[model samples]
Target: MPELTQAQRNSLAILLDSREERIRAQMDAANVARTVSAGPEASDMADLAEQGAEERMDDAVVDHYRAELGDIAAARIRLARQTYGVCLDCGEPIPYPRLQAYPAAKRCTPCQRRHEHMHAGPDGRR
Candidate 1:
């Protein structure tokens, strides 16, 4: 936003890199766990249940990590285009603090709230 100040860009980039590194490490660990936890050599209901739980947990972690990676990739593209920190729906510059908290944010607070509301289910969950 506003061409993103040099300091802001550096700070955001650092944050992105740190998050990316953490997620990548998590993916690696999850992959290893997936391999190791694929099954228990001993066949028993208890072992099968434990393995199933572990696999489910690893699946959740991988799903989350992939989503974050995709968001980071899109954010990087915006940065390259000099549009990082700009609200996609409002065409306004999102605050630096907001960007600091959410480097991949594509909408300002108000717009994001409205969007969530619009997309929320009848039970008022988004």
Candidate 2:
């Protein structure tokens, strides 16, 4: 694959940096939610149920952010290795627009779709 232009590199760097910042901010929020205690003891089943739901949601959010951080880190490694915009599957160049939309994408759209299809669970979720 051809090397990314200086302009494309700069643009992708900015995009990755911004995404990392946003993910970190969201992680902080999720962490706070997990750490914060419900001020009073639950008086009824409803309150307990609500607290449980909130905790689950917070955990899910934090987990998602952690995964996103990993993806961003991998993308940064690719950037440093001068392999940032190449699809991992077909070794073709990933389009700039797709990279702009998802800075951590490892595969081109078609390859990604195939990968998801292959890896999807019985419920059709990847």
Clashes of each: 0, 0
Question: What value does the lDDT take at residue 48 in candidate 2?
Answer: 92
| Model 2 misplaced regions, further than 4 Å | 1-3
Query: Residue by residue across 34-99, what tens digits does model 2's lDDT show?
Result: 667756878999999999898888787778888988999999999999888899999999988888
State the displacement of the C-alpha of residue 62, model 1, in Å, after optimal TM-score superposition: 1.0
lDDT of each: 0.85, 0.88
Q: Which sections of candidate 1 miss by over 4 Å?
A: 1-3, 39-50, 122-126
RMSD of 1: 2.5
TM-score of each: 0.81, 0.89
Please write out the lDDT profile of model 1 over residues 14-123, one tens digit for every residue.
Answer: 88888889889988987887787665474888977877787787787788789999999898998888888888999998888888888888889999999999999999
